[model samples]
Target: GRPLRVHSTEDGPLRAYRVYHSSWLRAAVVAVTFSHLLLALIEPRAGDGESYYTSFGSRANEPPDAVRAGLGRDVLWAELVMLLLYAADNMLKVYAVGWGNFFSVAAYSASSMFKTEKWDVLRIALVFAFLVEVIVALSTDVAWRPLRFLRPLFIVSYFREVRRWVAVCVKMIPKVFEMFLFILVVIGLYAVLGNLLFFKSGFYADEELQNFDTIGHSLVSVFVLLSSENYPTIMNPAFFRPDHTGSVWYGLYFFSFLLIGLFCLSNLLVPILYQAFKHHRQRLALKNHVRERRALLAAFQELDQNRNGLVTLARFTDLVVRLRPDIKKGDEDAATIAR
Candidate 1:
């Protein structure tokens, strides 16, 4: 259902969408989500993520009956019901967001909500959630079921920090790419050094040192070495063997690798994330500060209740009670029931 639009003046434009704005709706979303999460934590089904990836091809010929017997059927039905509700909720949001000029075909309908700038994240999320819902709903495979969890973006929207964190991370994308390029260059240089000092030195004549046999192998080996995965075993032959870089150069080579590969390039992420977070938080703070300038005025507009130009005290109190329901509490019973 369309929410009653609030405007300061009779002929003024509508303010914001309020279809999904009720506290009851918020509580329903939180309640349903936690129920599903609790069910998911305890219920183990046959077609989970690991089983799907590892056994899908092999089990392609297996009958549906063979996959699960009793309890899985119950879980599957519950999941389908939830997924349908999720899809329905997304459809309601589409209507809530977009304005339709039913009087004129010149104006777009519900789909036109995407054109507006303010609700871009919610718009993208609506489409993505619906798509995941449909895909999961049609398929019996439980692996795709995990995608249904993303339908809660609307719930998470109440916490603005998620959006702030996303904005900061989006700003860091270029900086991250720059760091990646530098790391690749360092890895490439070390790969060439491995090719020259080990493979070219005839270390590959022994099968034990075959990892350094080619430039590709040398590149991968350098990556493994930098990660410190089985480091001593992978590099000990090159270090101790007199035919290669030798014991004398071991400390200098590995130390330089650590200094360049692990320490220097990796540390850049810390400052970049910090800087992005700081800038985003400042932007949100300033935006909120500007919005607060119009706070009482906007509240008065909403409080007008009737389409009249000015608000009386009674209408003002009604709007406050409507907006903040906590003030409606009368006794311990009311408070407990509210909780």
Candidate 2:
């Protein structure tokens, strides 16, 4: 039995990839991003900011009055224009690549348009914020407008070094969290000890409100003392009584806590984080290097057409000319690299 099928006509993915990577399109996005940031800087603050519209009725049938005024009017118009431009840019990419490819939810790879662009999440958020702004415009509320301040994040994708730095920071999150938890535990223990030892002391009782009367207060006092803030004043009551005589061991407790918590444990976190950053960066560099070697190997294999594991100089030159038609065959400068 013969099977009959109908084929659907659609733009090819290769063509879509080409269009999305067009230089002019990228340049336009950069220009718009810069303009958006510039406008954000001068954008008026809330309560201090003015609105271009006013609402007179609570009914849905009543539309807001469009009486434009102040710097807000121009800023609002510019924002709307930028929104439209951003939307158009995104739409063009979507139209070329189809909706699924343009708004991918899968893991990142070279072929995924959304992941490669690195702005899908932020751009989608920006679009939603625009919609919210329009809905809230009638009531003259612009609380969500400050989200535009994140516009500079879009520019980070343009720089490879910046992206690498961001990736390193992201990778450090878990380790940083663990270290923070460890520090909190150490502080908690110190707080409990301080509460037990100092609760009945003259130091805690002299204050209008007892600082070390309970675990909670002791925790706050110890944390504050960690910063060495007026520590001598705090240590005085424990150091010397009204008769100028007290046990030296009272002062020793504060000194020991400062030594272990402030100088030792707190400073230990720095070298640990530095090591983590260094390791992640080295791993990233290795991954990139391997990828480059694999690509070069694949290119070499393609050049060795006869499968002899070696490419003739003539063959290499011909392949180069074939790959880039603009490079004329007889150009020695272009062919020299084939050697």
Candidate 3:
């Protein structure tokens, strides 16, 4: 049997790893990425000051506006700079982790790969879009800019905390699907019932198809009613006939649907999501704790110079200084805490 091999930071170039993990480098990348997104928003909009005819007219003869179609000059340059930086960032990671380890599908366990490798591929697509826009601008009247709105997705990847939240949300996908199916089933049942009870009831005008005239129409109406919007419009017709002769019993059907669908079932989603988030957070914390303990044990074993199970205070302080050189060597408190 073959042993399961695992790759870690040690497999990569140490110098590149240090530079990749440096605080200042991450801050610079984040700042540039955010500026790229900000510039995209504040750039001029299409037809802001033009006449109605020109603004809303057929675009067939109108000259292509590269800024409106693809990316404005301001955003284009920013995006170019950011993509270069991101590309460099990926290069550094590849150097640190090695090519096979960096791009391997099995390496997705490293959470950083969730954004890094995927976004690298997305960046390649974006570069192709940039080239197409440039070619179109130089050769034809048509604008084929694909980088207009997608450049901002990379910005979220720079925030480590946000990345974790996104991972948690991804884990909640199954639960979300379950909730969606439950809602669909409930809506289907109510739609069939509504169609049976309200078909040809004359509460809806002959011209209006939005009423429960068919199963499909009833489904759409009930779905809308589940949001509690236009409740009087839907309920008033059912409670009082078109001729103004009716009974209060019609109100019970709507009241029950609202009680179950609007108030009860819809509200179930909040707690389900909350519980999923809470569980994810706890699991993450536990995983981090276990990893920390393993790392600490490994460090302690390495620091134990002798085969015996103890480390000197001096050695521990030296280890601390080696790991965090920013700590002053003369700080006795750091050594004391190390003891």
Highest TM-score: give the candidate number.
Answer: 3
lDDT of 1 at 92: 52
Off by over 4 Å in 3: 1-15, 39-74, 104-142, 145-152, 206-209, 240-242, 245-249, 324-339
* Residue pairs with backbone atoms closer than 3 Å in model 3 (clashes): 12-96
- What is the per-residue lDDT of model 3 for residues 130-238, given as tens digits with 9 covering 90 to 100? 5465454335433334455775667645565666877898998886788989989999998888887888677866426568988888888888789887767777777
User: Model 2: residues >4 Å from true position, as ranges?
Assistant: 1-40, 47-69, 84-146, 149-152, 176-178, 197-217, 229-249, 302-308, 311-326
TM-score of each model, in listed order: 0.61, 0.67, 0.71
What is the C-alpha lDDT profile of model 2 across 1-339, one tens digit per residue? 111111112435435545556688778888977887787565554432433332122232455434323455667777778778777766655655456644555514763323325555466666667756744652565433546556667566444567778888889988688888887887798788777778776565766433778887877777877777766656667776787756666667788888987898779889889999988988988988876776677678877878998888888888777545568789985578677
Each candidate's clash count: 0, 0, 1
Per-model CA lDDT versus the true structure = 0.57, 0.65, 0.67
**Candidate 3 lDDT for residue 188:** 94
Arranged by TM-score, best first: 3, 2, 1
lDDT for 271 in candidate 2 is 88
Best candidate, lDDT: 3
Q: Which digits, one per residue and each the tens of the lDDT, describe model 1 over residues 1-339? A: 222433222222222234355577657756765665565553443354533233334454564343443344455467556555555554554454443432223333333312333333454465466556545634644444555455455445534566666667777777577767878998899888767666655545655533677888878877887777766766666667765556555567777887877777768867876776677778878977765655655656766768688876555455545545457634354444434
Error of 3 at 12 (Å): 11
Model 3, position 299: C-alpha lDDT score: 62
